[model samples]
Target: MSGTARTIEFDQPGGPEVLQWRTRPLAAPQAGEVLIEQSAIGVNYIDIQHRSGRYPIASFPSSLGIEASGHVLAVGDGVSDFRVGDRVAYIHLPIGAYTTHRILPAARVVPVPEGVPLDWAGVTLNRALTAQYLVNDSFPVGPAHVVLVHAAAGGVGQLLAQWATHRGARVIGTVGSAEKIALARAAGCHEVLISSDPGWVAACRALTAGEGVHAVFDGIGGAMFEQSLLALRPNGVLASYGTPAGPIPPFDIFRLNQLGSLHITSPSIFTFNKTTEALRARSADVFAQALAGVLRTDTPRLYGFDQAREAHADLAARRTTGSIGLSAR
Candidate 1:
């Protein structure tokens, strides 16, 4: 298991151009670890943040990427849950998935079900787990709830919308433009609004008969923070999970009380699935949703390992929809 691996690394955080391909030595898995030959790697907005230094990495010569899927090549001692040749996928914290091979703790790996494609698992696992927590644990969307999902045509947004709707919540989605409306609607949004519209907030309020929605899933941070707050009803929860637009600006805490005692929380997937048992339980739900047609399993747009820059460019420019991934082969 000692060999070379092709990886995308960056010496400094800047832009997409900072990502460079290089050959690095690989070693066998240590105890409680598994060596994997990756087939697909996920591309997420967080990856863009890491590239641009919006989310700083600890070192200069750092690898970026948190999710990938492939087959187990070897397993270390005390790892009997997985064997060589088992299809697996993982999403973990110490970013380094943008490589052809890697060694990860067995606790971090999940078995990809037989009918699910490795590519789909690679690109969708993180997002699916995110959606699971948002709809189930964050605010617990239900039949009586009316929720607003921002950037509904995007990766996690689409999954979130669908999962909320499946839970019987009335989902209203917002997209950057009218061009993305159909995709948002297809993802089970009962209504889609153009986010750029000056009256979009008014429209959302109108849709809820002026009472406002029961929950607001706002990923567009600063630009939409106040608006998301305005879209919620009394005691409604605003889950501020991401900030692809920009970090939320500081505002008076009293605004929550002024806005009908509303509540705001920033939820993280890592926190939701912090333990091995929690991770496996949550991943099982995602896999069951995909297998049962509650979550879509379509193939996503992919980039070759050499095109990592182009992939980041497309994702940051908002030129792609759904999930996008990288091919290791």
Candidate 2:
């Protein structure tokens, strides 16, 4: 609180090399906001999208972290639920989590349970909330349903697989490598396959006895989006979340009719937690599951705050797995 906070920022839109570390005097939180000294920061794929200009931003010269965990240093007027020294984490925010200290809306921060590690809180809230909505809202998965998740070993992938399994759904996953298959299986996937394999869709059909899955979670868009449609049975749902391979090409509505009257929706965390009540409910489910051990977060890879650039590069290159956290001061 005595000195300026340092953060990584990019003045021009480009690759990881554009991120630079700089310092600025820390400011007190405004009304309904709280100032936190971050203990850990989460590196997500969305950050890569923002950096590569795939996800358009209205402005530049911004810091780049969607979520993090830390203790409250001070609370502004009218804030009551949190106090100084409270452990908390949040998601769906503008650029700025890539710093040692920040001021965020008080409503966004949720008190974390003692059982959840600080670094785990940093990475879990966003991805876990996503899984919560996907399973509970976008499509209600149940014991009788068969769910297929793309990028099963990735952050959201692992969480979705675990949660779907808890709901009694037969959770299957698609990964890029054999090692990732083991990781996905450990995360409660009933079956795991390589997404790039030529016969992967056939394998999915074989698993369901030619019936296909009840739902397909399509994160790798582009041509894979069409393939996901083919892997669904009648009245199946297709949740196309991320476009790591780039956005899917425009298609006709009749394509859904052709593909068993399947339903497709693209969801973002911002729309899921649009209200304070929604945020409370979503974060509560996330922390409760983490506390009860219903969903196990894999050991996160640690990168020093200064190594943020390297972390981004690794994440974009697909050399990193699970969550990547930056240790804050």
Candidate 3:
């Protein structure tokens, strides 16, 4: 595996158009690494952030992407965990998954389980793992809990809603528009509210019998910070994980006390799955859920490597729903 890899890279952060194709020489896997011929790459909001300079890259001429699914082409020395031709998926650092071929640390890659499609794994692995931590660790939804999931029609949102519902929690989801209400409901939301409506927070509280929800899984960021707080009950937890709308602005900590001793904390998948053992365990849980039909395995909207710009544009505009992936084939 020592040839050219067709990759999507950017010389300077700007817009989707900044993403361009480049054929770079692919090197053999180093010790503790694995060469992968990626089949599908996930398109996440973070990728947009990296491309738009909201999240700065280390330098110019950077490749953008963090998650993908593919087959192992070669394994370096001392790597017995994976063999050539094994299906694998990874979501980790170094920001270079948007290519036809890549070399990644063996520790960062996980095997895609039987019955899981590589494309689905490519687009949903990161999100599903995020949902895993959010549901099982960050807030720990349970049978007696009532939870609110923002962007319920989105990828992580759908998975979160489904997982929470599977855990027997009463799930209320918020979508940007009415068109997505059905999709949210299909993902196991007991109630769906339009986030655009100013009274959505009130509606959520009303559904919870004026007590507010036990937890709020908010990814919309800044714009919805106060609203998310308002949607929580006394001593409720707010898991602020993403900033797709924009980074959350500084706010008063005392506001939590005023809001019935509410708790606000941000959690990251990287932090939750920091160790190799933790990463594999979490990935196994996600795959088990996927195989058990707890998480839907619907086909995601896919764009070719050449259409990376369009994919970013659509994602930034919030024009697509569920998961979307870049086809590396």
Q: For candidate 1, write residues 223-253 as lDDT tens digits.
A: 7999999999999999999998889998899
Displacement of residue 31 (Cα, Å) in model 1 is 0.9
Q: Quote each prediction's TM-score.
A: 0.98, 0.97, 0.99
List the global CA lDDT of all models: 0.93, 0.87, 0.93
Q: Write the per-residue lDDT of candidate 3 for residues 1-329, one digit (tens) a residue.
A: 55899998999989887888899998999999999999999999889888888887998899989999999999999999999999999998879888999899999999998799899999999999999999998898899999999999999999999999999999999999899999999999999999999999989999989999999999999889889999999999999999998889889899999999999889988998899999999999999999999999988888987999888888888888999989999
Residue 109, model 1: Cα distance from true site in angstroms = 0.7
Clashes of 3: 0
Candidate 2: list runs displaced more than 4 Å.
Answer: none
Model 1: what TM-score? 0.98
